[model samples]
Target: MGVPTLVCAPHRLLRRIEAGYLDNPYHNAVHAADVLQTLHVIVHGARLHVHYLDPLGLLAAYLAANHHCAAAFELLTRHTELDVLEPLSTADKAALRKLVIELVLATDMKQHFSTLTHFNTVHQLASTKSFAAAGSSGEGLLKSAPGGRLANVQQEFKEALYADGGPDGAAFASGGPDAAAAAPAPLDDSERLLSLQVALKVADLGHLAEQMEVHKRWLAALEAEFFLQGDLERQMGLPISPLFDREKQGVSKSQVGFFEFVALPLANALSSAFPGAQPLMECLTSNYRHWRRAEREAAAAAAQQQASAAAATAAIN
Candidate 1:
């Protein structure tokens, strides 16, 4: 915030970031902008400014939202686009760079379980402290100690993250049985830093919390990107990932799975942590229902086609 002389730094950096993103339907500058806007809404709506975050925290959150694809961007552009840091003092630049990198990397889907586990542990500890302070009577919890109530709400998110075999469960792991074997290592800084990391990760997937039309457009863009990947995979003679295989993967079906495994859990966790952001959970639920209905319709159409084929064969016989 102090780097007044470098007012255009963000714009220049965003330009570089935008150029780095591939010309895919999704994972491009527009999606980045969408996430940034959503992050602003969540931060303001939840009144995070009034509670846990400081200036640095807010800056990191905004950077994380806009540059969640920094790793991919770097690979595509062969540059880090960190020139914006030039405006700050050397020490401050280094610290901010580190924070930005950590926040961006936390958005990787592979880290989902580990990140949730760490956040859950922090939430649990905070809840324990708040409950002890509240004692047997939870009567004056919010009225007496607002911070304690906030902590409890944050801790309650852990339940949603791990509910009904969430991202951590055997079903979602790509590493086979060995994946679930390693427990999440305890995070050292179970404080503001951890909360910010969790918040940024949730914000990166903020599309799932948007209104129906916005969510549908983003989903279509993502599906188109996936199809493009499938095309590349075919050209390279490599096996395409299931969701990326346009021939085999139905957008509605794949989206339903994505919502179940990733979006819903994240939205629920964030909503629990920030009660004011509960509307995000509602949006996620609505999206899920929409996708589920689409999936059913797709399945019904396939079944009808198969029945027609069977009847034609019977008539020929």
Candidate 2:
């Protein structure tokens, strides 16, 4: 648990990171801060600190949240004053840099499904191992859990799902399809970087797990950014990306699709691995429901308007 001391005060480095981000509506400094805070919560709540990640890995995870892209890493490298890894051994420094880069890269939407798949594999394997070792018993399976309280909760979670033939229970019991794929590179006691990578990805999309009003605010900012991109594309005589054409895309439908395909699955995978983080899935579910309802209402209104137009045309004839 020997995290290195920073060359300068932590706030000094944080200020530089904050200043490096541009004024993009959804990708600015505030978004970085939100990801950092969310990552911190996920690590602690999931007990990653207790059982999986060492101090260096924990530091890397947090750093990846701020330096979430190659550009942000370049910003860090450009300034000697912000060398948080200045005090580490050469090997430790290399390891930390590699980890931070990989974690940041995983935040790319292109890698979204692949990253989620890997985490699911890890969780399934771990669940199978835990259950096997505990054989015909569920007690003390969560030794690394903070206290008896959470251990009990973990046990209850196990019993409710695995004992009741739940869908998740079947997946864990059978190790799913990724179990063989995960065997070659199983997790060790020292570092669970894969899990941390999943945590970073989830934190990047963390706004989806916020309260309804907060979630709407983030969606508004994101859509505004998308619309700006579409505007630039149109000006340059280029093709606009899907859902970025604000004039054609209905916000309700776009959000419903995004939540279903991207947000909810990722959040559910994380929560499945760490029951303590289940509240995240709950928030996401609520937000999803809101979007679905909005989608329905929008469709109904459109249909009504079309019908009214037809009636008026017939009257004119």
Candidate 3:
């Protein structure tokens, strides 16, 4: 909330970040800004400032929102343009850089399951601590009940990060498989940082929280990106990713499954943690229904086309 002033050098940095972003339909500077705005809405709607986050935490969230894709771009091109952060004190700049990198790297799709697992574990610990505190007072419950459990959960998260080969398991942070291995452990409040990582992730997919038209546009852009990748893979003689092979993948059906398997669960988890964020879950539900209808229509049209072709062949025969 108050951290915007602290950063104070965003325009130059944003321009640099924009310059480095891929020229894709999505995952560009515009998309980054969109996600940043969505993160603001989520933070406000969830009353994160009032409940879960301090000023520093909010700052980290905002930084993560803005720079979520910067690491990828940097890694890909070996860009050092993030020097716009130089306006801050040396220590502050370094901290912000590390935090932004960690948060951004956590957005890698490959890390999705492990990130969610860590978030869920932290969430459970928070719930247990809250319940224990409710029953007693003055840290007594924290000390007697969930203290050991909290330590264990934190350790597990740390171990998961190491297993992924980074302080933040930011496997893609430096474009190297093991670049993050030498990075120092995260310095912020571990629980708060983990939650913010998850929040930034949800915000990155915040198109699912938009209205149907907006959501469809984003989906189309993403599909275009996927198809582009598939085209490249074909040209390079590499196996194409599922749903990226535009010739065979039905966008509607794939989207339906994506929502059912990925988007909905993420929305449900966020809404559970921050009740005020239920609007996101509602929007996700609406989007899922729209996709399901599209999927059914697509299936029917394909079936009809097949039937008509078969009939014509029989008549000719």
Candidate 4:
């Protein structure tokens, strides 16, 4: 509704939608549902009497959903939608699309610290304002939050996350920046803009806190695709991760890397971000840890059973 100065760009948008579906490992219909549900939780948390959330709950969530276009590329693990953003017109339609795209693009793992820092600052500012206007016991964030404290923490967090400097050195930023890089932009704007950006941020990370079965499926899909991509890299003699040691058969040690270096930390960090999210985060944490513990248990049990079978075979032999 906010895309003024333009009527519609169905052709371009449709192309984007199609590419989003094609490229994302988890950006399909299921991913859409997960993101929407994540928004619902955030919205409800803000609705709580203790944390009224400055009445920014629902709209913020929806804004995230609409901005899902940018992450569609990385999550999909493929170059499924880069071309379409070009056809989008200038004026307001392009402007709104660009806004949504920039925030969505910023959700990359490489930007997590920086984005969180920004979020913490703005969040603190919003929180402090809420406190002065209405006391803390009633809603949203910590009541004890101090004014301007948000900005400082945010900066610190950003430096901590991105301290190595530039995302180019990271595995996650391999795709590079998206179309939103054009003309650059600022964070200030209308409620429509803020709501959308906030929503996109949470939605971008929403899947980390979903049902185990759901998260498992995403893991499986991405891993399978990751291996395949790694294989292609080997065939072309490109610089794929060493784990891919693809010259040999079977999946590489990369899955362990995924489990240890990626999923585990992601689950831990997400839980700390939202107190209301503890339960779901635990479930996800358990699931992420399953491979480590469960595999051992299963192997031990299998070994005992195999011993019994060997005894029987030897007795007959």
> What lDDT score belongs to each candidate, Candidate 1 first?
0.59, 0.65, 0.60, 0.43
Compared with the true structure, what per-residue lDDT tens digits does model 4 show for residues 1-317? 22122233334434444454545444455565556565565434322212322222322223344445645434323533333333334453355445656656665667654554454455445446643554323112222223333233334333433233322111111212221122112234542344334444555555444454655566565556666678888789998864444355323223334544443333333323333433433443444344445556777999999999999999999
- In model 3, which range of ten residues has the least summed lDDT? 166-175
For candidate 2, lDDT tens digit of each residue in 1-317? 47666676767777877877789988888988888888876766665666656666756654665655566556667887777767878788778778778778888899887777666555545567554544443233233222213334455544532332223111221222322221122367322677777778888888877766676788789888888899999999999888778888734357777776777667666665666566565556666666677777889999999999999999999
Question: Regarding lDDT, does 2 or 3 come out ahead?
Answer: 2
Off by over 4 Å in 2: 67-78, 128-186, 189-191, 250-252, 315-317
Cα displacement (angstroms), candidate 4, residue 148, comes to: 13
TM-scores of all models?
0.69, 0.76, 0.68, 0.46
Q: Candidate 4: TM-score?
A: 0.46
lDDT of 2: 0.65
- Residue pairs with colliding backbones in model 2 are none
Give candidate 2's TM-score: 0.76
Question: For model 1, what is the alpha-carbon lDDT of residue 99?
Answer: 70
Clashing pairs in 3: none
Better of 2 and 4 by TM-score: 2
C-alpha RMSD by candidate, in order: 10.9, 9.6, 12.9, 13.5
Q: Which predicted model would earn the best TM-score? A: 2
